[model samples]
Target: MMPSPYPLEKDLGMRYYASDSPGIGGRLRSSPEDFVVEELPLPISDPNGPYLICRLTKKNWELQQAVKEIAKHLGISHRRIAWAGTKDKNAVTTQFISIYDVTPEAVGLVRIKDILLEVVGRSQHPLSLGDLAGNRFDIVIRDCNPEELAKRVQAATEAVSAGVPNYYGLQRFGVVRPVTHIVGEEILKGNYEGAVVTYIGRTYPLETETAQRARRNFAETRDARAALADLPIQMTYERAMANHLVANPGDYAGALRVLPPKLLSLLVSAFQSYLFNCALSSRIDAGFSLTEPEVGDRLLFANGREDIVSSRNRQAALMQIRRGRCRIALFIPGSEPMASHGPMDEIMQDLMEKSGITAEDFERASRFVETKFAGTLRAISLSADVQADISGESVRLRFTLPPGHYATTVCREFMKADPYVMI
Candidate 1:
């Protein structure tokens, strides 16, 4: 029988390459102003293209809602709008979005509460994922003792210089419900119907009382009809799936189809991230340094393949590290091509077997519905331009990280507190 899945929470099972330090207890995201992010878009040539790019700054707005609003005002489908990346829902963020043939007059007409949009320029090519060099962050951590905070900061600085493990931020998985991966695991097991149940009926102990009751009732009775009333009306995806199940009864696969393709893709991707986290943690436990590259480890910026010819492979991989040209990384299993050598390979394979998967599942899982995945590289450590300042009861941190790396992971190295407690 399979072991019970690990609980998803802030910092649960995450590995820390930096040595632990005493944390100065503080609260993050005390307000939207406390966290700020701006995209560092890739360099562009002349703005002589068919695509209209806008620099949008949003405060306390979710990306999906903001996209839908822009689409409505522009008289186009949501799919017509494209962005380099998604920003935090509860953060102050600015990023570029490219829409084909959009007029400034139409952009001015967009009115999402707390969202501000501006037409930056025109581009021939739409900004796709990983188009940014990184993100710049300005953050404030409040209510920490000055003395302890300084020590923590000093420790964090050393860790930063040495490189901290680039673990996924707590926000990678939902903070409140943390069920994206749970639903994904069921999907991987070929239980389409079970995925719906897990989404609607699974409850965590830390969840709100109302949510707990709703999920517990559904889990016990397995009745979509009853759960619909119990689930908050704001849960449109859950409500849609439940409504379908209530009417169609056992059409599990159809129920899974209720979510939009982008959202559906996110669920599967989140699961892959979860496994990546586990694999990285395993490698750390076996004594890999976040700062150094080893013979068997794949690099973030290196082109990887199934056949890793041995002769110059180790020398080439290590050369990138020596020049700090590559970020350390682990592969998220799925139709993605990957190669691991030495102890790390054994560790990853062990994790696969424990999860009821063979080494082949890495490539086999790409066929699942809405589960589009390809082998990709992600850095396990990052290089950042960080600055810290102290003012009264708060510590202000400013930095820029490479694309796909999270600022929260950097903060975790210093705080060393339960993600909930620190943030």
Candidate 2:
């Protein structure tokens, strides 16, 4: 059984903090150039190996798009290339990518727009997601009132040091279409047809009028031939699905199967993220301390250990937390043994009853392992150290966060505004 879908909800606003924080009221990522991220890998690069490690600095290019272009240039299959993780397209991002059976010199001849690829080294194994320790972010906020930014950032930065609730930020879901979770919901319910339609149609206010026109036409007609003409060539997945269905005719599941397995996994993971966000929001609503564990509360540590809260050990746990030894985390349910307590426990119970997803259900996973929803613990709060620099009307915020964490989480505390518009 697939996990039950969380509500196809709007932004689950700030958690473990109130909305009354003063607004920095600045805009971020006005241009792709405004945000920069550099991967700080775990010093694991090996120079003597069969794998080619390449440093990629891509400006305004999606991570996968960059990989595709690199593969075409190097004359290698994209499947053989690997990376620590993905970076957002709407930024100047840099990360190390690895390819198998390639020499360092052969990897250097690749070229793409706004992309600089250099052979960094050779590693014994291809890098996989979560292989990195963290990423360093340089973000610029524009059109700000300097005094307001200074005041807001100061307070926000101090709050960040105390700890920022580790909710998955808006980018995890589609910012414009906002239908990733919707499609995820359909998949979990075993509605592949619904998933395909939700992904292809279901236009929203945030989407461009041009895109809405094409998608709406496709949705109403279900004509792959017409859709191919209407949709731009850039909608590769949509086009591929259309081509597949044009021949297969109403084979929705097979059409969905045409997508890359990694993408299918992302759809499921998005739903998991949605549920995690909801649980965190509920905990905050109940006015529970994210850092301070109370009796009957369950805790997850950074070193991948679990603990149960008891008065005898709660204080000791708090001390360990302050010393950066442990954190509070919620489980993403899978076909594995796990448990939770306190406000998080209530949220999970509610979600479980609502979603109808049980641990055993995860055993009946999709063909791909990534879609397994194999439960894992995630931190509820992060001890982020945000460094804010105010220069006239523009502010530059710099910070480093653990892998799988979003920098926008720190900025949202200061922005106190809608992510769709401001960031």
- Which one wins on TM-score? 2
The parts of candidate 1 lying over 4 Å away from their true place are: 1-12, 44-50, 301-320, 336-340, 358-371, 421-423
**Residue 144 displacement (Å), model 1:** 1.5
Task: State every prediction's TM-score relative to the real structure.
Answer: 0.88, 0.92
**Model 2 alpha-carbon drift over 4 Å, by segment:** 1-19, 337-343, 368-371
Tally clashing residue pairs in candidate 2.
Answer: 0
Q: How many residue pairs clash in each candidate?
A: 3, 0
Clashing residue pairs found in predicted model 2 = none
Q: In order, what lDDT does every prediction score?
A: 0.72, 0.75
Judge candidate 1 at residue 263 and give its lDDT.
68
